[model samples]
Target: MGGLLLVAITGIALVVGISVGIGDLPIPLATTFSAVTNRMGWTAIELNRIHETVIWDYRLSRALVAVFCGAGLALSGAILQSLLRNPLAEPYVLGISAGASTGTVAVVILGLGAGTISLSAGAFAGAFAAFCFVALLSNGARGGPDRTILAGVAASQLFNAATSYIVTTAGNAQQARDVMFWLLGSFGGVRWPEFALVSVVVGFGLIACLLHARMLDAFAFGDETAASLGINVGRAKLALFALTAMMTATIVSMVGTIGFVGLVVPHAARFLVGPLHVRLLPACAFTGAIFMVLADIASRALIPQQVLPIGVVTALVGVPFFCLILYRYQRVS
Candidate 1:
């Protein structure tokens, strides 16, 4: 586990460097290193102001935000899949993202807060609302995994419909344009503050999930088995749900809803490292961080002089993988 974490961190450093170096400006890897070291006061070497400004003010924050968003979403997915015993479970699929989008739209478009409530707060509130709906529909902790999954599907549709009604009927043209763009996802507008929020939220999420790793393993065999093992199945399920919701909401609010990271990354990580949440959780975070960074790079490079949406890039990769998973599951059953 120690060696795996070291490799993962090293990989993150290398990939984040590559991300900073690429772009319209195309700074060299050496220059990127100097800019970072100089900023940290490790070296006092002079560098071009433009390079420094771009790296510190813009690209660095964006890359870091991508890292946390990916990790948070993947961690949430892993937790959900284990607890629900559903391979297809994820925040987006479970209506958390849709609920967050609705909440954020209410705040931004309808001015729900009267200029006080921040978008992130609204998104979190909205995500919590979705969780409530799912819980109510599924009968809370008593619902079996299949029942909970069905509830999630219903909640997703309900929130999605609400979001569309608000955007089409309530928001003006400019707000509509902005909301549409945001729905697709972008790291373009994110800066240091956004990175700070995501990092703190995702950090707490990873730690919390790790501490509950043994409980999660018990959950995989079903709630009754977990209860037999003295795991408070109901309480544990609710706690895990809330944790996943908070993490998902924060990421959605910061970067818009980037899908597939949660759905795809957890499964990939689980495959590379066997089940057993202690090891699987870290593998998920690291793999997710790497995947999102690569996807961010692809979003920029795919269409020269024009950036594609991050969600689109992920979907392109995730859709085929999704089909493969479905096929395997079908064959297994």
Candidate 2:
């Protein structure tokens, strides 16, 4: 029943996204569908150039990007929360987003590199670095979820300070504006190749997390119980951590640090479906994808002739949702 519900929500989200894109122009639904069919070479119907550009080039790419980003972040959050046994655990909670932002900012401000090695590469490097630092700090000792969360908080603050300093010292208004936009996240420059890369990475991560769902459940009872069950807790944690970091890095590179989807979506899934990782993981993924698609549609259509940064739209939507979740959790407790 939960799976069916998730599928229904995702289907509705897709329809709404398509409608929003079509409504952006004077194009009717039939015309929009015809344009899409023409692009897919499914029919002899002809579409005007305006319909083609709006439907094929801009809206489709933006909507697909939102789906991927939302799924990736939500899945990442579910894994991290399970591994750390902390409700607040998320990709951004550990400074991965901040680190990625720092790397992207450096690339934009300094003109430091070229081609694929520029912004995306830099963001990946920074995210990996932050992951390693947090892992090192959390290793050994009685490092539970609380310790991990603390380590992530420290790392995130440090990275944010560095990124701020770099932006301010550059002192170029244009560069600052560029940095600001990237920091806030946008789906403006999404292309087929970029989407393909993100899809591959996110797919692998989702598989890894699902395969280890039992192990994650075991860990929820603590490391000793997992070890007693013949699960190598240490090895499992390391592998899951690496997978999450890689997936998060790929997304941060593409989207520039959208937040709260991971934090908010997983909790909402948990509220509806309970905390079995096997069920929760997939639920979170679908819910996240739907949430992000709606957010992206609003971002594009909320203002005419001006595209709002997707991250801003997500934060605006997510923060209030998050607060509501907290209140509900508190009431239950």
Instruction: Give candidate 1 regions above 4 Å deviation.
Output: 138-150
Model 1: lDDT of residue 236: 86
Q: lDDT per prediction?
A: 0.89, 0.78
lDDT of 1 by residue, 1-333 (tens): 788889999999888989998888998888888988988889998899999999999898889898989999999999988987878778887788989989999998889989899888899999999988987898955786567878988988998899888999999988888888888889999999888888999999999999999999998988889999998877888899889989998888877878778889999898899999999999999999999999999999988999888989999988788778767766886
For model 2, where is the 10-residue window of minimal lDDT?
15-24
Alpha-carbon shift of residue 47 in model 2 (angstroms) = 2.3
Residue 286, model 2: Cα distance from true site in angstroms: 1.4
Clashing pairs in 1: none
Model 1 per-residue lDDT at 186: 90
Q: Best lDDT goes to which candidate?
A: 1
Error of 2 at 59 (Å): 1.8
Which regions in candidate 2 have their CA more than 4 angstroms from the true location?
A: 1-26, 111-118, 136-144, 324-333
